[model samples]
Target: MAAAAAVAALQAWFWNERFWLPHNVTWADLSGEPGPPGSGIQYPRAGHVFSAFPLALGIFAVRLLFERFIAKPCAINLGIQDSGPHRAQPNAILEKVFTSITKSPGGKRLEGLSKQLDWDVRKIQRWFRHRRNQDKPTTLTKFCESMWRFTFYLSIFFYGIRFLWTAPWFWDTRQCWYNYPFQPLTSRLYYYYILELAFYWSLMFSQFTDIKRKAAKLANYAKYQRLCDAFFMLFGVVFIVTRLGIYPFWILNTTLFESWELIGPYPSWWLFNGLLITLQVLHIIWSYLIIRTAYKALMRGKVSKDDRSDVESSSEEEDVTSNSTKGVLSPSSNGSNRINGHVGSGQWTEEE
Candidate 1:
């Protein structure tokens, strides 16, 4: 906590020196029409710097909770096992049984292993397990796997923006140019669209699937699950709205090298912007439905003791699907190996 506060103080001081310390810096200055690159925009302006602080803080806090409160014990379970071509070594599985009740030696406080009751122990356990067991890959590999274009392009875009913001000549030469494929801004912006849309969909899909995965198993750790979903939903909305609303205007304003095609020759900027808006709108609707389903789960009581049978059945089904996907067990392998019915029976199809 002390370390976090110290870092925050330093960040604030840096921003103040860069922007706020100047009497000219004001809300009006920051909010004013986007300045010609470096001209009016101070490096690490107070408003931009402070705005990023919350985003960074929120990610750090959630990561900490998942590590300490949720992940610690989950590491105890799902012990690392060989998975497949995903990594050089076996990895953790993240999925596990929540409780293993044992009788209290003292018979005083029910000997419940919550460490603290009222908290969703199961949710914590699962969270820890998933994060740990997740396929370990290089940053680029993971970025590519999760997002086809966004990660690398954004890195490039941000790097370029930083460079331009520092270069006096780029800022001074405010003259804009335009021509379609020849326009540098149009091409860069087009690349950004590919990545942003992919990332937005991936994020929404993960949240939606996660909600359904535990809806019927409230005893596992309902409260924590709800909290996780709520947090994700807030970010999801931010991503969808910001991407949709800004991308269009961003493309229109920056694609200076392209000839203003008021009529024919549909520009790459319009194509990308239109597609992103449509996709985000569709995803928003889909997320709304998923949220409604999660809300239903929130209303339920404790995970019923009777649900254990269902839980076990579900686990067996999941194992079958996993094995099938990995080619670990053949369908005709007999007894324990033989899974009846359709090959992809219990699992969601990749098409989804």
Candidate 2:
């Protein structure tokens, strides 16, 4: 059948060894099965990577349970409450515009809607504000999200430390390239990578509804726990030493310079190193932003918000998040009817 033929062609293209492995390598060489009797070497199959996709779904289900019981109780104890938004009144006209045209319309668009519905422009605009607010994640919801991340990071940190304690590469950097891609992947390392892959998949699944900010202090900040000056200072030093120091000098040097001596350049090898270098560049940019935020918090004697955030208000800020400011209703002549206001200091704005 045409479908079967297409599927076979697609598989052939995707599984092409030339695109993934270095020259002289083939899929048979990567077989994970036991070899002839008396042979001690083990080569991991590349095909097994597909198994993690289902595992990732299982991890996501576990995360939902973990958030409900563990993270929810913790958030409640910390004074974070899940507050539901005020529902918008049913207006088919406004709702249609919201779904199809735009959630937050500019001044000109608001004027058109005002006349179309034969209602006050302010009323229509306020409806959109409340509607937008309905979609914003509650404080406790955001807290639970941060808690999940913090939990995974903390657990994985210790796990990695313990797992690598006796690794050959842990003792000598040169051991990293001893056999290169032809090396056997230990059972422990394979599971570690699969678990890591699943965790990232969980994040990806949740990202559609989650708050978009990438702040490091969200977990602590949401819990209302103020970190000590010593902790920030120590964290700053450790972050720089690890990210900017050991990363490039030790890890990058080994992968880029030393690895060349073991396995010469290949398409797949270049692609892998390209992603690695991209990550390093991101680390550099993040280093500057993170350090600056930490420095500001130190000077101000508090961690206020994400470094990228500005003053976030409900009516006004939601418009910012929606990528338009004109949704803010024009206040009364005296400006006393402004519906937008700031939340408490502990609360965060919608900015990412």
Candidate 3:
């Protein structure tokens, strides 16, 4: 819950680009020669219908639905299974299935059924154990599993003319048909920004003292954390430079109005330009925050109290010296000279 809240707060602060959608279609320069970027119309053309929808939806779906709701729940459950409760959460479900199997009269332990039933039960138990050990549910794993299960039927359904689906003319121009969406320059920039925000929240969640005990091995997270931060930093730079630097060229080289190749002409194109600027600016900010957070997280463990070894050693040395000085300064009870010379050398012949 804390992790979810942290992510929600970050989304509000850094990645709140929802306001840009309706505004993205607003006219920036109403008087300019009109035509959409490639077509000469005020609205999206049939060929470019897919481009009308932004890529932000895919990011949202992945983050909110798949990751937060599905994967996160499973991960948290598995993480809690190490020692919590007598039965790991999944075990309870597994036991129920086993009981159902055992209760079925058709699955009776007759001559040959005994061996087969034992093997089947063992397989089921093994699967449950494996699932219990995976503390985090990966999106890729779930996607791959779904893909594997569906691929055979999908292949059968589109056996002969599957190549038609691959054609750009028939497929959506936005590159978001069956595969994961939001791969374009505009969409991907924001996607990275979202990931940056997510990583920031993840690092914050890891900071909880109680959770820290569970995640002491930072090496597991350090690799991906650094990679994500580095990618966001680079993407942010590119976004800012591309949007600001190329806006003039995209504006000046407008032949779509003359060619009648665009629907929304300059007005629609300007909207895209404005949106690009806004998104890139936000991306820059998001990346900056992510970098800051990641750097802090990376240094957190290093700055911990474990570095007291040097101080402890020095204190111990000082204590020994102080004790020696006190012993030397103390007067002998019988007025006898104490250590008149160096103890090791033993060279003194008379007491001072």
lDDT of 1 by residue, 217-281 (tens): 22122235455455444544564565545544454334322324321223344555457567666
Tally clashes: model 2. Answer: 0
Q: Which candidate number has the best lDDT?
A: 2
lDDT at position 220, candidate 2: 51
By TM-score, the best candidate is 2
Which portions of model 1 show Cα errors greater than 4 Å? 1-181, 184-227, 248-352
lDDT, candidate 1, equals 0.38
Instruction: Please give the ranking of all candidate structures by TM-score, highest first, separated by commas.
Output: 2, 1, 3
Query: After aligning candidate 3 to the native by TM-score, how far in Å is the CA of 279 from where it should be?
Result: 0.8
lDDT of 2: 0.72
lDDT of 2 by residue, 56-135 (tens): 89988988998999999987886777875667899887888888855668788888887888878667767888887787
Q: Name the 10 consecutive residues with the lowest summed lDDT in model 3.
A: 210-219
lDDT of 3 by residue, 259-299 (tens): 12322334344565566557656655655554454455456
